[model samples]
Target: MRIVSFGFQTWGRKTLQALIDSEHEVVLAVTHPASAQSYKAIWADSVEELAKEHGIPVHLTERADAATIDLVKQAEPDVIVVNSWYTWMPPELYQLPPFGTLNLHDSLLPKFTGFSPVLWALISGAPEFGLTVHRMDEQLDTGDILVQRSLPIGPTATGTELVEAGMALIPGALHEALSVLEAGTANWRPQDKTARTYFHKRSDRDSRIDLSWSAVDLERFVRALSEPYPRAFSYYRGERIEILAAEVSTVRYGGTTGRVVVQEGGGAVVCGPDPIRGDNHGLVITRVRAADGTEHSGAEFFTRGGYLTDVPE
Candidate 1:
């Protein structure tokens, strides 16, 4: 089938590559211009370059403008496929093709519908995260499902790892969706919006550590914001420090939340909620990075034994 692709960053590039390798024809590619945002830079693969290398038509735009719509209309694709297109897509654009638009979102539909889905899923403690190819609708990711693929989230899985795993699913899932579409046997399933969970884009503020959370949650937070993405961070001694590696402490200690109580597990035991009861598992910060860009073991860095506050002390 003839296809038109809308995407951005590494996710977009991978989707375009899969479409190029498939039996379908990718007639046009629409992608956003480069971004300077921290998150956007992490997976900074060039969709425009790949499309151009293959001699497919490429249009660089932040969103689907009238001219982009006209370009798609002229391309006259049989179907439209989108991934990581960071803007609202009007119905006139998505519904232009006969088969409508097939969006490849990096999460299971009816959950993790918006930006940074893999990160949000890991932070939310979901056992599994996956990709879904669904028909586009008026709402964001509230479309009918055509194909779905999932991967188990291990206890030690990081956000980067889960993202790569999800990207690997694109080839199989896209191929399956296209096959069904070609055979006219696509079994589209309606999403239960009641189970839908949408997450906003991640920003610097989202990485700030909140000591009120349980140690397990904080540990997961650190892993969710693992390298390439912003590390979970807090302030200590009026300086910013990024938590690069952490885990739940095996011991419980009582103290005010954020207090650097004791050393344990080759790291510093930082108190969380319910400290007075002495039943809380403190967060064991194993590794950290200072504002000056130096890395240090948590135990070595927190030798002064202060508190990790969300704001400067």
Candidate 2:
């Protein structure tokens, strides 16, 4: 099969590599320009460079403009494969190929759609997360599913680990989908729109720890925002502090939600919800990064005892 690849960053690069290694030929590659966003920089692999190295024509565009459509028409690909390609693609573009466009999303369809799905799945205490290859349509991630690969969310899984796992699923999923498409035996399943849960793009503000949440929830939040993806953070005594590692406390404690009430195990216990009733388990922050960019054990940093507030005091 002749293929056109639309991708960005490491995800796009990986997809292009898989196509290059496959039986099909990649005729054209479309990708976005470099981004300065911290999230985009994390998995920074150059799809454009990879395509150019292989001598495949590359088009850099933020969206599917008139020139891009003309290029795809000239390539005359049998199918289009996409991953991490920002911006909307119109029907005239996606529906151009005989088999239509196959999009790779980082979460199971009918749930966790839209941006940063793996992180959102971890933070929401989901049992599992996976990759999905579906036919692109009018709505975002609402297309019929062609192939899916899922991984269990372990008790201590981090955002980085799950993302890598999902990326690894791309080769197998893409190959399988292509085979089925070639054989004309693809079993495309329609998504149950009722079960769909879409998430918005995350900003730095989304990482702020909400003290009202249970310690269990907060622990998951910390793990979800683990290394290479912006650590969960809060303010302490007019200074910002990033929580790098944390867990639910062994002992229960009650005070104001953000108060650094006591030292427990190897960290400091921050009181959680229901302080008046004094019945909530505290979040034990084990590791942290201070405002000055110095790392410290949570116990060592909260020695003076103060409140971790949402904003500078």
Candidate 3:
């Protein structure tokens, strides 16, 4: 099969490699124009580099411009495969290939159908998440599913961990779906409209912590936004403090919510709800990053006796 691949980040690399390994002729590779500031750079290796190595044409553009479309059309590709590119693709672009375009999404369709699906899955406390490869339609991620695979999200797994796990399955799923497409026996399942849900892009403000939330909720918040994100955070003395690691505790202190309850072992306990069977919980701080850009243990953050507080309007 003559394939045209549109992708960015590690997922794109993996999918392209899979197509190559599957004995398909990848004639053109398209990716986003590289930028230095955003973390997109981390996962981006020069697609041109890989294309050059494979003697394939490469297109790096901000959009599916006339030149890019011309390049793809010239490649005479039979199929178009989209992996992790962030831009909105127009219908005409997807319709160019004879076999049509297919997209591999990191989350199961009809549940999480937008950007940052893996991150939203972790924040939603879902124990399981999956990948889906579906035919591209005029709508985003609303295509019929050709292949799907689910994986468990361990209790301690971070957002990055879950994304990595989900990304790992894209290659195999893409290979299998392509085989079905080539054999002219592709079986697709329609997505349930009633089960569909979408999440907007998360902003820095979304990472802020609310002391009024239960401890378990706060703990989950901390885990979901850790590392790659700015970290779940709260205000203290008019300065932002990032919570890097935390635990939920049953012990309660008479102190007010967001007040420091204890400081020990380089970590500190913050006042939160006590645990209940069907109802309450408490949040504890195990690690943090001070506003001055200093990373500290929970105990270190507490030595000054500064307490977590609601952000002032």
Candidate 4:
């Protein structure tokens, strides 16, 4: 098949590699322009590099400018496969290929249709999450599904883990979807609009932790934002402390919300409620960043703690 690919990040690199391995003719590749200021440079690789290695034409543009469209027209590709491209596709550009454009979405379509689907899934405590390859429409991710596959989100899985898992599934899904398109026997199921859910981009403030929330909820929040991104945090004693790791403990410790009840075994039990069990629960914080920006175990923070007062405004 004569193919053109549009994507950014490691996911784009992996998909381009898959096309090469499958012996498909990838005539061109498109990706977002690199930025030096943002942390995205660490997480994403240049798609242009991959395209050049394959001797394919590459377009690194924030938008599909006239020149990019001309390049696609020159390639005369039968299909355009998009994976994790940051920009929205204009209809004219998407329809340039004869077989139409297919997009790889991180979540099962009609469910998570916007930015940061995997992160939202982790934050919501969803046990299962998946990917979908679908026909690109004017509406975001509201397209006919070409293929779909589900994967388990282990209790400890973070946003990074989920993204890696989803990336692993892309090659197989792309191949299957492409084969169907080539055969003109592509079987697509219409998405259920009534069941669709949407999410907006997460803000910096979204990472803040609320002490009033249940231990279960807080635990999920901490796990959701751990490591790669900023960890969930709260203000204590006029200082910001990042809660890096925590667990819902069985120990019964009574104190006001955000109060430190006990410190033992490199862990500290803090007061919070349990929404699931409908009782007061203790948060076993294992790791944290101190007010002075020093990283330390929960036990260390507990030993130095005075009274954990109310959340600062």
Candidate 5:
């Protein structure tokens, strides 16, 4: 297939690379400029660089502008493949392709429809996340599904772990979708709108740990915001402390919510609820970074305080 591509992250780089590795012809690659939102390119490979390596024309823009639309028309690609795109795909550009626009979303269509799909999936304690390739229609991830495959998330999977696992799955997922795209006999299915879950863009503030939540729930929350993303955190004596690792204890630990119930070596047991078992429980924090940017044992660091709470003095 003659292809035009769009993407702005590592996922996009991988997707475009998949096309290069395939028998299809990639005529153009559109990536993003290093704007404020994408300054974190430390984790992202250069799609533009990769495209040049493959002798493909590259364009860096927010979206398909009038000039870009003209270029897409000139290319007359068989299909337009997109992944991790921050901007909308204009109908003028997507419709220019013979096979239409195929978007690769990280989560199952209708579920986690918008930004941070994987983070929300983990936070919700979902068993699995399905990678989906769908026909784009301007709506955010509400397009007809072209190809999808479910990937299981372990009970204690961290955000970084989940991301790496998804990255490893993408090459195969893209290949599978490409096979369907090439045949031009894709089995497209409309998404069930009632089952959809969408998440908004998140910030470091969103990583704030809520001590009042159940141990199991907090553990999931912490894991969802763990390394590669901002670590889940809480305030101590008006100072921020990031929690890198913690364990859930189903057995009750006596103390108020957020209180340091027990401290031993690197682990500090904090009070929590056993919402599932209908009993009190605790979260044992094993690793932490204090407000001063110093790493410390959770037990040793929290030993000076009896409780960790948002309550005013």
Candidate 6:
């Protein structure tokens, strides 16, 4: 099948490679241009570099402009495969392919349907998360599912770890969807409207930690935002401190929320709630990056009485 793929970042590279490895012909590969912003997220293999190595044509653009649409139309693609893309694709672009568009989403549809689906799924304390290859519609991720599979999220798994696990399944997932299409046995199901949850793209504020959160939730939040996504952060002394890793405190500390309860080799123990069930729990911040751009053990950064609050302390 002739395919035109639109993607970016690591997921893009994986999905494109899956297509190349398969029997299908990928005529055009489209990706986002390099960013000039400081604090870029973690990345894997470059989609552009991989496409060039495979001799696939590359198109770099923010939006699917007239020329891009024209280019895809010229490719005469059988299907459009889109994964890990940021642009809002118009129907004209996805509808160009005869087989319709297949979108590779990080989570199963009707749940975690929007930006950072994996992260949102993890933070929501879901026992499992999955990937889905769905037929794209006019709505965002509201497409009918063609194929889906779920994987367990281990207790200690970080966001990067989960991402890698999902990436490992891409080749098989894409193959499954493609095979279904080839055999004409595609089973499409509409996502349950009641079970749907849409997560918006994160911002600096989204990464900001609220000490009011329970230790378990705080830990989940930190891991969810860890490397490749932005690290969950808080302000201290008018400087931003990114929390790379943290743990639920062994001992409960009662004081002002976000107050530094202790500074030990284990990390900075911050006061939250007494872990009695639903109250805020304590956190042991294991690792952090200071405002001066220096990474440090939480013990090295937080002094006794130095609170890690939203407001500078």
Instruction: Estimate, for each residue in 53-86, the C-alpha lDDT of model 2 and write its tens digit.
Output: 9999999998999999999999999999999988
RMSD in angstroms, candidate 5?
2.5
**How displaced is residue 308 in candidate 2, in Å?**
0.6
> Which prediction has the highest lDDT against the true structure?
2
For all candidates, the clash counts are: 0, 0, 6, 0, 1, 1
Q: Considering only N, C-alpha and C atoms within 3 Å, which residue pairs clash in candidate 6? A: 273-280
lDDT of 3 by residue, 1-313 (tens): 9999998777788788787778789989998777764447555666657767788778888788888888988899899999888887887789999889999998988888887788888878887899999989988799899999999878888887887788789878888998899999999999997899998777667888877676666777788786666588888767888888988765544455666655335433454454233233346687878889998777656766656777742
Report the C-alpha displacement of residue 162, candidate 4, in angstroms.
1.8
Expressed as tens digits, the lDDT of each residue in 1-313 for candidate 5 is 7889898778888888888988889999988875545224435778888999989999888877898888888888988999988877777777777788988888877889998888889998889986888889878899899888788989878887887777676778778777887877678899998998888888766788877677788889888887678888887777777888887764556655666644444444454554334356677887889878899877777767666666332
Give TM per candidate: 0.98, 0.98, 0.90, 0.90, 0.92, 0.90
Clashing residue pairs for model 1: none
Record all residue pairs in model 4 with backbone atoms less than 3 Å apart, i.e. clashing.
none
lDDT of each: 0.90, 0.92, 0.79, 0.79, 0.79, 0.83
- The TM-score obtained by model 2 is 0.98
Worst 10 residues of 3 by lDDT: 272-281
Residues 235-290, candidate 1: write the lDDT tens digits: 98899999999988888778777888546744555566568998998888989899
Better of 1 and 3 by lDDT: 1
lDDT of 5 at 274: 41
